[model samples]
Target: MNEMKEAVGNWREAKQFSPADENDFLRWLDKADTEEKLFSRLTFWFTFRGLPADQNQRYHLVQERARELRLWNGLELKLRRWQDRVADEYEQIGKEAFAARIGEDYADYINSLTDPEAAPQQAAPEPETAKPAGVQAWSARELSEMVLPPIRHVVEGLLPMGMGVLVAKPKLGKSWMVLDLCLAVAQGEPFLGFPTQQHGTLYLALEDGKSRMQTRLRRLLEGRPAPANMHVMFQAQRLGEGLLEMLGEYLDANPDIHLVCIDTLSKIKPKAKPFENAYDADYDYMGRLKAFADSRGICVLLVHHTRKSKNPEDSFDNINGSTGILGAADFTIVLDKQSRMDDEAGFLLTGRDIEQCERVIRFDKARCRWVMQGTAAQLAAQRRVAEYEAEPIVKTLRVLLQQGDGTWSGYSKNLMEMGQRYAHTELAPNLQMLSKRIQELQPMLWERDTIRYWYNSNGNAGRKHNFRQERADNNASVPVSAQLSLRHNYH
Candidate 1:
């Protein structure tokens, strides 16, 4: 041990030696033939025993001495070249084996403190497993199977996990609808068109008045008791904060929360250009929310509005803002009025990965609820009605006219033929109905006409009675007898 300590001190002193001396020491090591001779010479030069039970400690000391001597040599051409060669040889000796001697941790600790102010002292990092170069370059399989969260179909099953949307035009019972769903879900009752299973929920509504929300909830629940697990948050104005920063605190406190509802996304997102540029503010905000959901495995339902140019035929394409909003959503639904005065409204289910069926739900304003519009058989009947309504009579007439070479003179005959063709054995009744319907639709048909009309007469003696421009000479009157005579001759 004393010899080892002396060798360590000499090694530190050797770091200050000139390049010529370092060269002389290397030459002496090369000349030594036996291990004992080599050890004795190294000890004499370093002024310490060069051997330790651990080969790593011995090699580390030798490398350290080499580095110090090279630095002491300071910019000499031959010395610099020699230092590079020494470093290559040192690295080739297997750092892991050397590292294992004092344990990699202690080796790193000693290395770090050599220049304490220059580099931060840190815990030694665990050795990373070496991946093959081929693996690094290889692409993942395109058809790799993905694991997705299970979907709950029933309202009872959905309510517990968080699912549903309340939608309507402004001031047309949107809030009221949401309140109703919340009350139903909280009480484990049947919710608009579906039965809800009970689960702990978090309701966060920023826009609603406290009193109004409470009153509406009371109306929705009527006499039912509220669930103790149901929680309400009147304010959630800052949801975009880092997941671990904002929600981490809340989730730590309330681990039981399963369903989370943010009444409107507009209130939560800070005023930014989510609409103009999707990748900027919109992506960042949604990314944070999605990460939060994934980490917690909680269902987050966000209520939003339809675009001003919303098409009744399509629902998902009509949602407002960067398509990213809807693109990120797992499910999307739209509520719309079928007519201006119709009390019954419809909800169009647009995007749901699970169901192939398109559902049409009717809103019962009196009960403030949604109910499935028709039974299976009733649905078939309604489909027939819809088919009949959509079968365009005018379009059929236009097609007939086209087939008749675009002449109104042959229009009636062509119409009769078409009626006969379509009516099969009921031709006469069909023709009669067609003629009546056409007569009833004449004004509309004439308005759609693309032709002009005029009248002409040959200058025969019988046709050469009299002519007058009545409007041109209203006050330039001729005798009443003459005018009567002229009218009679013209006729």
Candidate 2:
């Protein structure tokens, strides 16, 4: 293969090709170790030459090679992806023309290829009998009027019955969570306060030994007996090697199976080729699993890890791999924590079938299971209130207000001195940070603690702040006008 690549490179550099070069390429293709490798090299060469025109000599050479190798499925996969990516542009060029270039027979078979993302077209309903097969088109009105079954969920309102990725930092209880999910589904139990459908489940514990899994299971079960329907495997073949076929056989043997969990995606995924685009590699690998799951109408949850650096704007961006993984999935669940030491973590869920949700879950160390705390917004507000009560500056302000007549008006410098004298910890690094913190906490303070803070900067005298405590009974909510003026006055 290396020699073949060098030969192709020389021909490309010289901008010339002869019968001898063509013979050498054909011979190398025959010597290729596997069909997948041959396909990879061919596509790399094709793409390197800028996806040659249909009439070009190189394009014909590739088509002939693909035909001789019987790489119709590979060609079809590429065409589908290209058609999907380029959409209207591909329609303009014609899908049949592209498939026919590979081979005429493949063009006929292309329509039969299952696209998980594409809706199946059906003919108009008959007067009595069901619509006959081979009806490929549907008008917009027909599509809109067609009644489809609702998407099923393995875990109600959280996980839909399709392929999904569960991502979190390593050692953040992802394995534990999925293990619990398997048991819950197998036994028809509620998981994290949500009801789960009872079904057979397969857990691919590729990274853990039986002993470790047993220990975790025992811990989770406590006095209860383990469910008989949940099966676990310690090792498996890589995806292309035999993983899918093995799973198919397993499903056939256990016809009741509805959930298959892979501990870590990296373990079973095939090794990527050097020439393959990172995004394309992820999409292709995940797309295969997605197709298999959708066809079986089961839930396949892939356990994955998040990137070290966080994306403040988007939680999904923190997923370790390229966007293709999320792009190919039906849904994605990300588990995030502000700190590993904290017992509570945010569980984010988003997908096509389910509405987006964010929940706060706390790890119950005793049972080795996550307990639902509440909605994310509620928990966040509670945390803020707790923080405000314990904050040194707030404590210092309370003491000063109590020592005085429940009102303090002074410059930030004076407040800093008073805070240091009265408070045990430093209020902040400097007067600037102290002022900012006070303003940042204004809403919480005013709304929760009946403390109204007003600060303004004077030209040469520096910033002056006025803090007054309102009667607890009189405090209801911060006025809209005051909330709007909070930042302005602080600035």
Report the C-alpha lDDT of model 2 over 10-68, residue by residue, as the tens digit: 32321222112233344433333334444433533342222122114444444444544
TM-score of each model, in listed order: 0.46, 0.56
**RMSD in Å for candidate 1, one decimal?**
24.3
Per-candidate local distance difference test? 0.48, 0.73
For candidate 1, lDDT tens digit of each residue in 1-491? 22322333332333322112223444333333333333334334322221122222333334433332333233335443644664464367544332222122222223333545533332332244233422322124311322223444325322322233434455555565565665656567776657875545677777877786677666666667666767776776565444235444564346555557777877787567444675456666766665565444455666777667866666656667776765555555566765646654555553444342344556566566566674445677777556543445445545554554543232334545655564332323554465455444444444444311111223441111112222322344645655564354335
Quick one: best lDDT, which candidate? 2
Which candidate should be chosen as best, given TM-score against the real structure? Answer: 2
- The segments of candidate 1 whose C-alpha lies over 4 angstroms from its true place after superposition are 1-168, 241-248, 273-276, 374-491
